[model samples]
Target: MTVPLAATDFHADLDLALRLADAADEQSLPRFDAADLEVSLKADHSHVTDADLATEQAIRDILHAERPDDGILGEEFGAEGVTSRQWIIDPIDGTANFLRGVPLWGTMIALAVDGVPQVGVVSMPALGRRWWASAGDGSWTATSDGARRLSVSTVDSLDEASVSFQSISQWAQAGKTPELLALAERVWRDRAYGDIFSYMLLAEGRIDMVAEFDVKEYDIAAAVPIVREAGGRMTAFDGTETLSALSALATNGILHDSFLSLFRDLPRA
Candidate 1:
């Protein structure tokens, strides 16, 4: 018989994740929309700003000083110090938005233990908002008013649910426009909230579902715990519980299987 993995406390790790976000915010927030900000294109044609590099390096510097044994996988910089315990960083989750003076962008940080994200943090400094969660601790968010525990909407029927499809072009590019349209038709409303904010809205119970394609571990790792802790479910488009699958579908826990069923006939990614 196989035994379940023992549950571990992540309070400390969650604290560290929040601190990492603070460091990231300090480094990147000031650079937002700066006239002197430097910009460049990565080989993949994605935007990379000086803020991205500085924010990621700031987080890395803290991990190196405090959690030296843990590994890191960042969007701006490649992986480092391979280990079972890894810190995933996306200095700026929406670089284009950031450069365009949109406040939807933020910094993401997560601590994945043995491949499962145990702690997650998303800090939108420009908006003066933040959200975070750790295994068993429950998800929470903060604004100018104060902090409150997060909970996903209880809507169980797709016909009554609200959804966010990050990009229509992304759906077309993946050849899943038919499936996307079908799902959108089933829902009461559909919007393109885009980027990390969409998932955070799901956690806040303001939205019922979020589906997007062409993502990476750093793109969604920090969202896994936040969504789950908020009483929601998140998985790859093919129904796998992994961050590396390059796709994501998140919904209130009651609506997860139903959402996955919509894509059941599609080929696995």
Candidate 2:
């Protein structure tokens, strides 16, 4: 049952992405609130456990069987096969939250059309919520028990915006730490959502902006469409149309150009 890549109808693909997210949820939710949050650290200084690997492998198997023709790029398994229309997966996006019973953790899935994500899904089983959007359908959030629409806030100025930056180290690694600090100086407030959820909050209008450096394709691929469709904008530091693996900025539409100007000259702090 290979999922074909014949220019997926964004609406249909977004629906399937959420269903795929459900499959991941089934594998992750029970372990999420486990009595013991014990975890083993990876050599790279990051963390992973059976839940992360298992959830990702389970998703890969489903993608392999359900969309054999479609390619996949995932955090746990790396990239596989060929197709411009690949599905990006971050099986359990905030292991720290999952490990600590924080409930901000979630799984991300997105269908990239010729390298641009056109359908995105983010599901947080512990939180009992999920959000999704396609190129044109707009973003939405649903709980295991209900439904609701999500959109960014109308905060137009950086001084009024509620923003989240994934990590301080992420920007430092890219030599954008100074730029980040400057932006921080201007914004209302900030926190580190550290993964997919920050972008999710941005789309839901709960957070106004998110910028991160040193990320891979799987990290931001799934959030682009959801944010864009929710009346927001997402692009690289240069304000390009394409979402890059290196860096990304997602902002409510009202703050797009104004914020881009911040990146014009990297500050030295």
Candidate 3:
């Protein structure tokens, strides 16, 4: 006889994601700045460290044992299983920074149901912080101080918004340098806080917007739920809800349209 499983228990799933993140942290933190850490390049020429590999493997092992039926799509190991319930993971979101001893890197874990992300956890052990959210549960962060709810900034106008577009090179490479420059000129402030950190800051109400190019599904999947649950909006640069989009744009819900409008006339590559 087969037993019926709990029906889409988001809270329980979120708890599991956090536990996976904890395991990731354990695998990553010890190698963060290790002098002997191994580094290599992927087919795309991007860097990958030992920490990235080990962390993803650790998370994958847990998922294999605990949630055998769920699918997994990971940056380091590629995809496994085929199911509506999928776990998307980026064991180390900022490997470049992590390799250089920068504290801006983190591990990202997310669960998607029918292709819609319903849970997310971003853990930055080096920064002493982590953020998590699940469908129907508000976004939250844990710091040395303690855990607290998170929210996006209230700034409603581009002139008053603080934005980060990851990096100018990304826009330049995407053939949208002029557009990016124009946006920086229009926003109240602009910084290249690049990577998963920018979205975390946006979710914490510390920044107003984040847009980036050349992102992958694993790069933005975990961020979707955290930003959305924190009362923000995230979409492709063309203003569609898709993680596979080549670009990503996120902002306080109020400023989403205004931000999208800036790219309306630009041609996509």
TM-score of 1: 0.95
Q: Which one wins on lDDT?
A: 1
TM-score for each model: 0.95, 0.89, 0.94
User: In order, what lDDT does every prediction score?
Assistant: 0.91, 0.80, 0.90
Residue 68 lDDT, candidate 2, scale 0-100: 91
lDDT of 1 by residue, 1-269 (tens): 01126878999998888889989999999999999999999999999999999999999999999999999999988899965899999999999999999999999998888888889999999999999998888999986678899999999898899999999999999888888988877899999999999999999999999999999999999999999999998988888877878899999989989988877865565
- Could you give candidate 3's per-residue lDDT for residues 1-269 as a string of tens digits? 00123345598899899999999999999998999999999999999988899999999999999999999999989999974889999999999999999999999999988778889999999998899988767899986778899989899888999999888789999988888978988899999998999999999999999999999889999999899989999999989877788789989889999988876855566
Clash pairs (backbone) in predicted model 2: 3-66, 3-67, 152-205
RMSD of every candidate to native, in Å, equals 2.6, 3.8, 4.3
Stretches of model 3 off by over 4 angstroms after superposition? 1-8, 265-269
Q: Model 1: clashing residue pairs?
A: none
Q: Could you tell me how far off, in angstroms, the CA of residue 205 lies in candidate 3 after the best superposition? A: 0.7
- Residue 17, candidate 3: how far off, in angstroms? 0.4
Count of clashes, each model: 0, 3, 0
lDDT of 1: 0.91
Q: Return whichever of 2 and 3 wins on lDDT.
A: 3
Q: Per-residue error at 245 for model 1, in Å?
A: 1.0
